[model samples]
Structure formats: C-alpha cells, structure tokens
Target chain A: MMIPTPSALAYVPFVSVANMMRLVHSLGPEHFLSELAAYIEEDFRRWPDFDKTPRIASHSRDGVIELMPTADAESYGFKYVNGHPKNTRTGHQTVTAFGVLSSVATGYPLLLSEMTLLTALRTAATSALVGRYLAPEGARVMALIGNGAQCEFQALAFRALCGIGTLRLYDIDPGATAKAARNLRAQGFDVTECRDAIQAVEGAQIITTCTADKQYATILTDNMVGAGVHINAIGGDCPGKTELHRDILLRADIFVEYPEQTRIEGEIQQLDPDHPVTELWQVMRGTVEGRRNARQITLFDSVGFATEDFSALRYVADQVRGTDFHEPLDLMADPDDPRDLFGMLMRARDA
Target chain B: MMIPTPSALAYVPFVSVANMMRLVHSLGPEHFLSELAAYIEEDFRRWPDFDKTPRIASHSRDGVIELMPTADAESYGFKYVNGHPKNTRTGHQTVTAFGVLSSVATGYPLLLSEMTLLTALRTAATSALVGRYLAPEGARVMALIGNGAQCEFQALAFRALCGIGTLRLYDIDPGATAKAARNLRAQGFDVTECRDAIQAVEGAQIITTCTADKQYATILTDNMVGAGVHINAIGGDCPGKTELHRDILLRADIFVEYPEQTRIEGEIQQLDPDHPVTELWQVMRGTVEGRRNARQITLFDSVGFATEDFSALRYVADQVRGTDFHEPLDLMADPDDPRDLFGMLMRARDA
Candidate 1:
C-alpha cells in the first residue's frame, strides 16, 4: 500500500521598495504620474466594487499611526502610515509610510514598496487630478502654505499636471520655506517666499495647505480666501488637525474623497455631519458641478484614502511588470507537498 | 544666496522571517518556547497598556482575509493573515500569515516576519499556556482531532509545556492521521491512530479539534464529551464556522481570549451573544476558577487575537537580538536633513 503524497504549489512574486523606486524612476516621472492618474480615475469610476472602511487608527499623545486597507475581488492593498508633529525635532520626517499590494485570490503579497516617496507622488497626483475639475482654467499661481517635505512635490506636480508656472510659499519655519523656494527654483518654478500665510494666499488662483501641526489652527481664514480659488487642504488629515477655518468650510463648495471617513478625519470634521459635500469622483464623472462659477471658492478636503493607494499600487505593478528593476524575494514557501509544512522546515533545517 | 539643503534622518531596523527562523533555530526551540511563554505571560499581565480592536475581516466565498492591528505608546504591530480551506485542494496551506512590528515614535517597520510558522508555534504555546491552568493536573493523554499542519506543533508544545506524553489522533482523511502519527512518532510522542473522532476522544483528558472546513460542521457533539475534558476549539474561527454543537457549548464552562471578538468569530458564535463566558486572563490571574470539578467540561474558544501576535513579536525580537541570524535591510531612510526626503531619492539616484 502506497502512502498519499502532498501536491506542489507555485511561488508568489514580491517587489521591494528599492527595486520599485528604480522601476518608477526608470519609467520617468511624467509617464508614472500620467499612468497613476489614469488608474486612480478608473478605480474611482468603479468605486462600488471595493470593500471600503474607515482606516483603523491608533492614537497617542504625540502622534497617530494608521492602517488603511482596501480590497477588490482580485487585489488587496494597504498602507502603514504615521503622523508625528514633533518628529522633525528629532530630525525625522513628520510623516513616513510604506505599503503592500497583494493578490486577494491567493492572499500572497506581490509588492512591498516604500510609500514615503510614493505617497508624496500620489498625494500631489491626486491633488492635481482634482484640480483639473475644481481649479479655474488657465490657473497659473498656487499659494503653497506649510512649505515642508511635501511642498516641492506639490509644486512639481502642478507644474507638470496643472500648468502652474509660479508658487507663493509660506511656513512658520523660515528654513522650510527657504528649502521649498530653493527646490522650486532648481526645478525651474518662479518662487515667491512670503512672510505670512495671508501674503502667500494673496492673488493666488489656487491655495494648498500641507502643514504638519496637530492642532486646529486656522491657517487659511475666510478673509484670506479669494473668489475662484481652489483650496487643496492636505495637512488636516486627523481628528483635531485642521488647516482651514470652520468659516472657510461653510463658505466654500466642499469636496471629499470618502464622506464617511472625511467626516471624522478631514476639515469636514469641523462641519456638521449633515453638511452636504460632493465626492471627487462625482465631480470627475460630471455628475456634480465642480466649480459652478469662476469666482466660487472650491475646497478639496484632501484626506488621503486607501483607494488612492490601491490605484498607485496597481499603476506601480503595471509599470514594473516587464522591467528589470524588481528583485523577487523568497517570501512564500512552495513545498512539494503542501500538507508537509513541517517537512519543508525539516528540509531547511537539514540543508 | 545659498541653496537650502534637505534634512537627513536616522535608519530603522528590519528583521525578516527567514532571518528570524535561523535566529530561533540557533537559539534552540526549547529556549525559544520558554522565552515566548514568558513574553506572552508578561504582556498578558499588562493588557491594559495596549490599544486593542477586534480584527477587521473581509470574507469571500472561498476564504477570509483579516487585518489584526494593535499598539501601545511605544510600539505598533499588525498581522495580515488568511484562512482558505480550499487552498489545500490547490496544494496550498489552509492558513498563511505575515506580520510587521514597528516603532510608534518613528513609524518605521522594525521587523517583517513570516507568521505562518510563527503562528503554529505561538498557537501551540498559547494552547499549552492555557492548558497549564485549565487542564486537569497530570493530564497525560491528549486527543488531537483533525490532524493537519498544526498537529506536530501542538504535540511538541504539550510535551514540552504541559507534560502530555501521548496523542490520540484522528482525521476524516486517514492520510492526514497517518501523517500526524508519523510526524509525532519521529518527535518521540506515543501516538495512537484512531478511526473516528469518538475513538480519538475516548480516553484523553484534553480534546483539541482544529478542523479546517469553513462551515458549521460539528466535530464534537455534547454526547461524545466527558467530565474534566479541557477542549481547545481551534479551527471554527469565522462566522458560520464552528466545531462544537450548541449543546456542547451549553454543557461546557466556556473561556475565551477576547470576549468581544470571540463572541463573533469563535465557537461561541453558536451560543447566544450574552452567553456567560469567562475570559482566560481572569483564570490566569486567579480572578476566576478555571475548573470547578473533575467532571466539568471546560471549553476554550480560541479565536486568535492581535495581542498574541504582539506577544510573539516581542518574544522573537528578544530572542533574535545578539544573534548573527538577522540581515539588516535599509528599509527606512534616515536622511541628515529631515525635510529633505527628496534628497534621499537624489542620493540614491546619484549612488
């Protein structure tokens, strides 16, 4: 009598961040941004197919750490991110992130990439994607408040995607503004270093706030807001974190990514839960008015969502498929007999 | 004017699973298990420090994937795990898992370890830990029902931790029982192969049912159980999946890991939502009696929790330290200028 043997399984593929960066850089920023935007738009159009939930967050006295996970039938994606306002004091990025993209069918991870760089790229890309509908046509100047790690990416993305030629930058830390100004100048943008947030927003067609403070400080007051200005509020992403004043939200036509989540995490937290806000996808699909009038104040309460990471992962996976930039890791075990997980370990031990 | 420079940050450490195994093997399994038990006990003693949430699960037609996340003020941890009963048909393990341990202050992943192997070890260790308090003293014979991938680890842990000398194994597939018998025989356990579940549970003081079907199939009915039988119900871990009939739960004095989670995911899902169940910790801490009499049926509804992974990760971290098994990956960028996240890319590009 012969004993039954376990069958063999195939190995899953994994792409590390270093390799992913090489893949994205080799593909060129323009192509990557364009492809990522297209992917984001596509996924947004099929929003109902996703399993969406408000991100799970762990909060402490000093910072907040969050896990954003979303899945469709075919793929699963998640990002691990943190927000520490005092991290810069210890010479660290205030926010650092990494993400994984996996095959939902097999529950095997396909890509593990450093989202620090990708997050900056995706946030800028998402802002620009929303700006296409919300920002007035021929918009040239963008007031960039909180000139920190994210400012240069925002400037460059708008330059490439929104045709912005100039930036008005301000920060409480003069050094941060100086860094943004220098980086923008090197990237060939006409940069103005403003002394105050009011000076920065003055006469700018679009205003973006990406500050790192964990307070409800009003960076943009109602009086500083001008007509026809597109407000991309990026920094106010957690509870008690807000850049735009409550009056600004009340006056502007507010837009959000996920209404259920935005109600708790975005600038919309300052507004009533019953306050009507249009989703960005509705505006992108022409189901809702984006900028009703040339002079209307349009707000994009840009709290990052898992869907954006899903799109970014998909785009990265597609761009890196045939490229030599990915190095596969032996992350999963494929044994000749699947039931013999113990056998595989014994073999490894012996070998 | 000087060109403002980007800030650089400090590096974070990452220990992968392959490295962790090599480290653990070098440390020896006995020492590792002892240390793991100590870590788990220590963490359980200070359970209030953790910010715990019930795992978020996404169930599919075939299987279920879950994200278990938890954190304290100092460290953060999460595990991505999947349970697919049909995976064995395609020559895959019924369960696979991986986890990350990160710093709360820096938000960088410190360790990325495979929990497939670790899960087996930790589950066995946990079962044995509970057995020490709940099982009858001098319990020598254990009936291991559904002898699949987890059988060997359970046998070994009981032998090491709970002084169990013999295992009576049974599976619907005789091949699985044969495999478990062979594995345990080599591991120096007195193993008896049984034709049916009733025969397997006949003389054993502890009965462990870890079947892998995703349905409400009862492996143990009320009539089959006897007094002083400590039951570890391991596999009926999702909604609509259970090992014991409703009568079995009613007859047994039930204990669980986390009441809120176990009420939904464990075998207690078959019971009423407000069914009287004592937490295992209460027993461990002497706050409640484990077994009132020799003939009482004590059921442990073992739905895995994040706190267990947190304990396992902490144990692995301690064991792997000062060993030559870990290969450090440059996972987090520690640029000299914190604001110069862009500078890290430029440096990498230049290098």
Candidate 2:
C-alpha cells in the first residue's frame, strides 16, 4: 500500500514578516489602522465576554520574555514577546513578537503570524480607538514626543481615526525626528520637527509620550501636560519605566485597560494602590463617562493588554482567510488513524 | 534606496512535522529515545537549575489548551499543547503540540518545532528512564494495558534503555491491540495479545497502564498488581482521571515528577493531601531511595512536567544543528536600524 499524505488538518496558515507587510500595504496603512481600530473597539465594547489573563512573564537579568494569552467563546489567542533593553545596541529590535490564533472548540491553531509589525499596528490602532472615546471633540493636531519606530504608525492611526491633520515631532536624537518628519511628509501629513517637547505641544490638542528609555524619566512633567489635552503615555509599560511625571497621573482622570495589570506596569504605578481610575472598557460601553468636559485632563495609561492582541489576531485571521497572503505550514501531526500514531510512523519508512 | 531584507536575527529555525520525522529516522527512534532520556535525566539530576513553571491552561467544555513554559539560566522553552477527547471522533488526534526554544540572554527564539512526535518520544523516554531505576533488575517482559499510539513507543524505549525483550499488550478495543502488536512485532519483540487487562499483567516485571479514557478508570485492581513489579501509570494525568485502584496506591511506594502539579493531576490525587510521595528528581539525585527490595512495589505516577519538554527541545536543537531537518522561518521583523522600523516599512513599498 502507498503511504498516506498529511491531511489538511495538519497544516496551519502562517503569515510571515514579508506577508504581513504585504497584507498591510494591500490595505493602506491608514485604511488598515481604521479597520483594525474598529475591530478593537468592537472587542472593547463586549470586553466582559473575554477571559482576561495575567501575562506569564519570565524575567532575566537583561530582559523579560512574556506569554500573553486570552480567549473568547469561539477563539483563543496568545502572543510570545520579549523586551530586551540592550537589544538596540546590537542592531536588533528592543521588542519582538509572534502570535498564534486557535479554535476554542478543537484546540487547533488556525493561524500563526509574525506579530512584530502586527503589534505595532495594533498598538497604534488601540491608541486611536481609545482616542475616539476620550480625546477632545474635533481634535486636529497631535504632538508626538518620541519619533522612533512607532512614531509614523501612531501618526497614521490618529489621522485615520481621529481626523488629526498635522503632527509636531520631537526626540532626543535629531536623526529620529528627521526620520519621522521625512516619513510623515511622504505620507502626505503636515509634519513639523520641533527642537523641544514644549514646542511640539504648543498648539496641539493631543500629546503622546512614547520614549523608549527603560528607566523612569520624566518625558512629560506635570507643567508640560496642559488641561483638556489627552495624554497618551505609551512608554511607561513596565515597572520602574514611567514616562509621565507623578503629578500628571494625580491631576488627570486616568483610564486603563485591565487595572489589575496597569497598576503594576502603567504610569499609574506611581500612584497609591487605592487611587481611583476608570476602566476604559466601561467607558467604551457607555456605563461610565469619558472626557466629561473640554477642560478636563484625560490621561490614558496605555499599558497594552492581551485582549488587544486577541482582536489583532482576529482581524488578521479574517483578512487573510482566502487570500494569497499566507502559507500553509505543517505545524501539527495528524495520523491516518487517530489511535495509530506509531503505525503511521512505521509506514513513513516505507514511503 | 534599496530595501534591506530581514537580517539573520529575524529568522528562527523551524522543524515541521516532516522534518521532525526525518530527524527522528536519521537517528533511529530507539536511539533517539535513549539520547532524549539521557538529556531528560541530566536535567533531572540538577533540577534546581531550572525555573519550573506552572502550565497555563484555557479550559472549554469539550477540550483544553495549555502553554507550558520553563527556563534555565541559559535557555528558555515553552510548548503549546491541547487535549480534546472528542477530537478522535472527527479524525483528529486527541492531543497535538508544538514548542519554541529561546535564548535567555537575548530573549530571542532559537528554534520552533512540531512537538507532537517529540512529545510522544519524550513521554516514553521519561517512563523508561524511570524504569531503569525503579523496575526490577534484568527485567525482560513488560505488560502494556493500553495498546494505543503510545504502547509501541513504550516497548521500544524500554527495550533500548533497559533491555526489555518481550511485550504483552491489551486494550478495550481489540483493533488497537492488534495494531500495537503488529507494530511492535515488526521491530523484533516477542509479542502477546492478551484477552484482558488481567491477562496482560500476569508474570510481567513491568506494568505500564496508558489508557486514554478521560474519566476515572480501574484498569488495574488491587489484587491484579503483583509485588516487585514497577507500575508506570501515565493515562491518569489529569484531575478525575485515574487508572489504578486506591488500595493499590496505598500499598505502593509512589514517585512523582513535581509534587505541586502531581498532587492535583496524578493518581495520588485520590489520597490525602499530606500523603508522602518521593520526588523523582531527588531519587535520581541520590537524595532519596528509588526501590530498595525486590518484593516492594514501586509505582511511578507520572505527570509530565515542563522541564522534560525543555530537555526535548534542547535535544532537538542540538541534534539538528547542521542538518536540513529544519528551515529558516521569517518569524520576526528586523529593521536595519533598530529604531527606524517605520523607515524600513516605507522602503519595502518599492521592493
């Protein structure tokens, strides 16, 4: 008898880094971010249905590796990510990641994708999605204080979702600011390269601090954050890594994704344990108010959560279902007879 | 400007199902299992060097998906596995798995491998390695009560590791028994097809029960177990799933992998919480005794641990170092300038 070929169940759709970039470019960055933000917003509205998980982290001397997992009734997703502060010195990304999406019923993986670019996309999408709920009405210009890898994505997502037309960029390195200005200008945005963070936020309604220093540095002090401006603190994601000053957190109406985790990693880590903050999902669901008045300080302690990654995975799985954007990988072993795995191995030698 | 391709750091070595089988056949399964058992035993001897992890699991009505992660000082590894009892009804295996091995210093993945076959290999290797210390000296016969996918591998591993020369097999389904017997006989073993579980264990020096029923099962009664025989009970690995009668456990000197996990999943779950059990690592390290006399019952209540999977990944990574048994996978996004990820994306548009 001839040997049997592997069944279709053995293959999983894998989106490589190249394929992910292709998928993103196929749908323009602005369009992709808008659709992705909508997906995240939909998940946030029904956030009570998700199994919110505490990321399992393995800390080392130089960096940390973490597995963040979440599940809904139909699907389960998890991301494997690492943060090595010194990786930049070696010409490697400070954060790199990959993720898997699986079926909750069968426990079989549906898609395995390069999550590095997807993570950047989803983080930008989430920021814009939250901005829709919390940013000042008619928010036009935004100030970006970190013109690094994520600068352009954030600019694009804000423009797509919140109607931000102009960007003021500032960074410690003039080269980073130039890169952001050059890229944003090429993408048809009115970009201004500012020498200081103060000048960057001069006439902007939204101020985003996304510096990459691993230590606690006051990139945005209390005085720099003006009233009625939405503050998106993206860099203060790990313990002892805050970008905003303590006074900013105390003065602003802080909103967070999964307070249990944000209390440990977000800018709110500088506050007392009992300090009150609004859950972002409740605000998105409309049970709690967001941006009560135009002059109120609204700060989003943007510690990325697993549910956002879940939504990103869901979006990618939907967008690449029948397209030529993915390859079938033999990640699983399927036997001709479920109970005869050894028999199958024996037959492999014959073929 | 020319766009740069992903650097070497962006690619991880991936061993697919075909590659894993090819690797296994390159170094024959018996030899592979023996070497793998040595790797496992080496890890067991210095168990304190490992950062043991509690597996994270997501449970649904019909199935459960789990991520088991562990790290040593030098390397980290994790396996994603799922158990769905009803999957066999739809031509899927009850269990399937894959894993990633990473470098601890950089937090970068070193290898991604299909682990279903590796899991089967490692599980049998662990049992046979434990058999070397616990089973009676010069034992030549093993009675396997569950003759499904795992039975032949158990026989092969035991023979290669401990010099077992004969086999007696039985399963609830006679078809399964026939399959195992045929597979084992082809590989040069004295095989016997038994009428029932009672007939299978008669006069055997090693009794291995590996049924796949997801509920409580009495595959071996109190009287059916003879003294001086080492009982390897593997199927009763989850809560509410056990094979041996309570009386049999009470009479035997039990051994376990990790106390905290085994207390919840192993056969000893039926016993008192404070019941005494020997840690297998301690025995392997010579801190505790394994089997003292020929007349005493030695039961290895095996609940698979994360360290064993870590060891398997380590072994495969080492074995396939220079071989074509793996492929380079574009799993991470690598920008030429680590901080200029957006610039890299923009340049990719022309490429």
Candidate number achieving the greatest TM-score relative to the actual structure: 2
Question: lDDT per residue, candidate 2, B1-351, as tens digits?
Answer: 967688898899999998888888889999999999999999999899988876888888887889999999999999999888788889888889999999888888999999988889999999999999999987998999998777888999999999998999999999989989888889999999999989999989999999877788999999998889999998888877899999999999999999888888899999999999999999999999999999999999997899999999999999999999999999988888888777777788778
The per-residue C-alpha lDDT of model 2 at residue A107 equals: 92
A1-351 per-residue lDDT for model 2 (tens digits): 647588899999999999998898899888999999988988999998998877888888888889999999999999999888788888878888999999998899999999988998999999988898889998999999998878888999999999998999999999889988998999899999999998999988999888877788988878887889999888888888899889988889999999999999899889999899999889988999999999999999998999999999999999999999999999988888888888777777677
* TM-score, one value per model: 0.96, 0.97
Error of 1 at B219 (Å): 0.5
Clashes of each: 11, 0
Top candidate on lDDT is: 2
Worst 10 contiguous positions by lDDT, candidate 2 chain A = A342-351
Q: Candidate 1 at B14: error in angstroms?
A: 4.1
lDDT of 1 by residue, B47-166 (tens): 778888999997778888889999877889998888888887777777788788888877767777678778877888888888887888779999999888877778877887889989
